[model samples]
Target: MTTSVDHDVSPDSSRRPPTEMVQLKHPGRVIGAVFALLLAFLLFRSFLTNENYEWEVVGEYLFNEQIMLGLGRTLILTAVAMTVGILFGIVLATCRLSENKVISLAAGAYLWFFRGTPLLIQLVFWYNLSALYPHLGISLPFGGPELWGGETNKILDLWFVALLGLSLNESAYMAEIVRGGLLAVPRQQTEAAKALGMSSWLTFRRIVLPQALRVIVPPTGNQVIGMLKHSSLVSVIALPELLYSAQLIYSQSFQTIPLLIVVALWYLLCTTVLSMIQSRIERYYGRGSHPTTPTKKSLRQRLRTRNEEVAK
Candidate 1:
């Protein structure tokens, strides 16, 4: 007698779920649509109620040379402040993580003072620095020649006060961001670098910082955008930034709402553009570690492969 072969298959094998047909819902899209509708309705009502709500007036003020110049100044201040803030933040965060008690204490004190107080108060304080100290000067610890030059009243200058206050305030928050990023880096990374005979600086520069950048960049971008808007607060000191310029225009034209709208629109535009840039940067950094698709290929290589497949 000959043995017979049986080909039995499980039922589940033939009844696999269709993942390709699965539908996913996005709540964000719905919420955004609703918010857009509400905003449009409010804008329409404002236009109808205000006989002086001329779109041309808004455009004119927006494009005015003086306003544009003020906008440029605002951008410059934001860039300078953020740059200085992040630099100082790195130092403060590193100090906080240091073994030295003095450095840690100093860093803690800075964060405590800045974060505890309102930014507005800091601005005013900086604007009136001359009142606190009649003659300001910088010198070496052992009392050498002055570092450069200083004038107490000079601090009250709009740009000087804006820069000083913004940089100092931003540094506190940046310290937090840097600390978080540093903490996100696994302890094992530092240990491994040390095991390989790397110096602390080398380990941080080569291994830790590169990884931490992914975590830090998004928040840093947010801070940059916030700084841009916060620069408007310097208008209190008569800085001719976008908002101040708008105020001057409205003061003359008596178009408060319209001028205010122009300022809001500019802020919206700047924030939107910055957000787009942030998204691109985040996407770039996230590409390799993306959960949806994990691959070791370089971005250019991946693009090339896709192009080849499409051509085929």
Candidate 2:
């Protein structure tokens, strides 16, 4: 009787369960999606049919040379200012997080002054800086021969002022973002690095920052897009960015809405590109956060290597 024991009654087979696939359907979700699509369709139809948009003029001036030049200036300003801001922001954040009170206070005061003021006000101030300080100079600590001196207006042109205003303001905000990211790094990780005889700076560079990037990237991206739009404020000082160029044209042509639509479309295109870049960066830095997903950078590097080998 005992010899008739079933082989299928083994522990492994007992633990195995039959596979069943589930497909969830919610009528409320379907209805809500349909309603949203209907609303979007109606809104788009209105835009297409509306005469006020002046689509013909928008098409005509979309690729105008003046607009292209202005867009180039906008791109240059965004790149330069963000580069400067991020660099300065690193220093400021380090100061704020340092052990010394004097350094931290200095960084705090800098942030307070810049962040408290509106960006538009800062732009206006920079544009009119000569009114307050007619002369610009660099002097030694003991007041030796001035290293450099010039009239503020001569040196601080509209372009320079725009860069200064954007960079200074952005540095304040970026410093805060950087500080938050640094603070988010776990104490245990730093302790472990120190145990391995790593210097503070080396540990920070190799361990802390690599970990902090997962937190830092989202806000940094937001700052980038914000800086791009903030560059528009320079138009008030006649720096001739995309919006300003459109204004210059529409002032003569009386096609305000059309030119606005054109630039608006361009801005939308730019932000879309930036958003895509932000996603790629986020994915590259997120490999450890999600174990199952793969990174694009490795695949891209492999493909590039293959292409170069083929060329060779």
Candidate 3:
């Protein structure tokens, strides 16, 4: 006996031609071309101007040992200050989030005082610390030995005071950035970790912080760039950073605009480099979370295909 078998097929199961390809946007190409032309035109016009800016002057200052040294110092100061500031910021954020009233209150007061005051005033305050207090020494809260001793003026004379002031001032803003990042983390994440028997510290380190870093890094990068530029302010106290070095050169040659141009170029270079770094960091942190283009196959289908391949 011959048996007739019935087959069922859905018309929609048939594959259709790939949808018309969407054109990739080239916004950057247009912007870049326009900007490049504008820059070239400006440079050509500057060269033809009667002021006759000496390109040699720019080259000389650019390669000058004093200027280079000052640039190096500025970079170092920025790096050190940002590092310390971020660390202090983490501490402050933790304190602000603490269950203890005293800790939270102290953190709030610190943030308020630093954020309320001007950075320039803070710098001047550090520079003139000796005037405020003649002697500097570590005193115990209860009854311990005075472990440290130094004259305030002598200590302030060193770069230490400037570093301290910059770090402290920056910490206020950094604290806010950190707190925002921490708050951005979902409370359910903490609860889930706790449900899994993870301790608070472990949960924070492994789960919350890693996710919060995505939110924190962007603003933190901005703060770092700001710190680099703000290092110029220390020049008022004879820090001899890039801006001050330029000032010294212009004072001698009286080519104020040219000297200022050199400074501006260096700042542009630094900020540009920093912005590239920020982009890379953001991309790295965005890996899995970024919206991906969906393919025809669902995730389960993809996984089944992989499993089949493994079986083969």
lDDT of 2 at 207: 98
Model 2 Cα lDDT, one tens digit per residue, 1-312: 367756666454544343333457799999999999999999999999999987988999999999999899988999999999999999999999999999999999999999999999999999889999999999887868889999999999988999999999999999999999999999999999999999999998999999899888989998998888889989899999999999999999999999999888888899899999999999988877976644566656676676565544
RMSD of each: 6.8, 9.0, 7.3
Return the clash pairs for model 3, or none.
none
Candidate 1: tens digits of C-alpha lDDT, residues 1-312:
999887697665665342222246999999999999999999989887877877778877778888888889989999999999999999889998989999899999999999999899999998887887877878888878887666778645777788999999999999999999999999998999999999999999999988888999999999999999999999988889999998898898898987888888888999999999999998887667656654545555666666565544
Q: Candidate 1 vs candidate 2: which has greater lDDT?
A: 2
* Candidate 1 Cα errors over 4 Å, as ranges: 1-52, 138-151, 293-312
Instruction: State in Å the error of residue 10, model 1.
Output: 13
Error of 1 at 179 (Å): 1.0
lDDT of 3 by residue, 93-187 (tens): 98999999999999999999999998889888888888879999897879888889788888677478779889999998999999999999999
TM-score of 1: 0.79
CA lDDT of each prediction against the hidden true structure: 0.87, 0.91, 0.87
